[model samples]
Target: VVYYFQARGHGDYDSDFSDEESGEKSVQKTKSVKEDDLLRKPFQKAKQGSVVHRRFAAEEWDREEARKRRFHLISMDAYQRHKKFVNDYILYYGGKMEDFRRSGENDKTDLDVIRENHRFLWNEDDEADMNWYKRLAKKYYDKLFKEYCIADLSRYKENKFGFRWRHEKEVISGKGQFSCGNKHCDEKEGLKSWEVNFGYVEHGEKKNALVKLRVCPECSYKLNFHHR
Candidate 1:
């Protein structure tokens, strides 16, 4: 790589001067050329050096790309696990539990424990990140408790459609006519008739479809209504 800092002047007006004006212009041009060469000499002298040779440059680049892809995949997997762990933790502990904070029972500080676990978790792959997962769950629970007592269960992607809540004042039905629509729930008591809309494919063509349903209180509150 060679870099020339000073710009070179284009076009040389030689002393094929036809008259006085041309001769003066040629003299000025010659002077300018001489000055440029003098300024450039030091840089030219400094350019003498052996070529810089990098061993396995191509191999190193390939390895770097592979390392980046591996890191990305690992991070994505870790993040998905983290979210699931946090969700379960929030549901179970509700942020109100013993050992949520650093107690005197543990002799080491949080930082010290985490640093030690860096090595321990590597070997114990099964229970690698349980500690941090618990910690995060507790942290989120506290935040939810302080800000709003109710959880935004709707934001959770329990299904293709995020939760779309509907109150029961609208649906009309008779006794024993409605039942819980949720597959997970078994509410077969007094309920209002509801509907579920989804897409279906027929002969490779996509089409819309609707099904009559009866959602119970618990399932209605938790389960999603339709696809987003």
Candidate 2:
């Protein structure tokens, strides 16, 4: 059953998911998730419309833009043979072959690019904190290999760019082009990720924006509940 989770503030601990279809089916639960200083400390400084939030958001906008512009799609063959967690593509900043810092094969994956090249890639943070970031980055990337990067065989090869599973021989145009438009997902290819128009908002003076997103599959399932 598809459900929507209501975010409860930290430390209070009550979290719940309400079934979209039944409306009466609501499950209340507590999450054991531990938050770090970002949630407790930095978050205070990063308040909406504050100087801190604006500063990081602007820098993040630029860095994310650069990552997409520099993306180099690795062949499917490389992804399959990967001993570690696989990625959609790699990043190259200089836009040239020799700029790769790795020795021998000069091979570096998106997995390591951020940590190794943080000074260049991450512009928002102060330079003095980069060393701490480097250590943190290492642990995070190692965890990435274990956690979020797992290749789900069920969801595998569904063609992340709005394509059907390979088994379907015939398919209609504009059919399976999006996963979900409800919540945000992090596949790391941010600039042109699969975006399906969710809805529209009317602005008094400015043009209306058609909301679009690439969200997790569970959220995607909610879209079909009403149709059934």
Q: TM-score, each model? A: 0.21, 0.14
RMSD after Cα superposition, model 1: 27.1
Give the per-residue lDDT of model 1 (tens digit) for 120-228.
1112343455677445433333332111011123433555431112223212322113445443444676555545454544335555544445556655555453432
Regions of candidate 1 where Cα sits further than 4 Å from its true position: 1-158, 161-178, 223-228
Query: Could you tally the backbone clashes for each prediction?
Result: 0, 0
Query: Lowest-scoring 10 consecutive residues by lDDT in candidate 2?
Result: 144-153
Best by TM-score: 1
lDDT of 2 by residue, 1-228 (tens): 997766664544543442343344322111222433425764365345645577788999999987775453343355454522222223322343344345767666655565354321122443455565465554443332110111122332342322212112111221122322222333322222233322222222222222333335554443333434
* Clash number for candidate 2: 0
TM-score, cand. 1: 0.21
Candidate 1: worst-modelled 10 consecutive residues by lDDT: 144-153
lDDT of all predictions, in order shown?
A: 0.47, 0.36
lDDT (Cα) of model 1? 0.47
lDDT of 1 at 13: 42
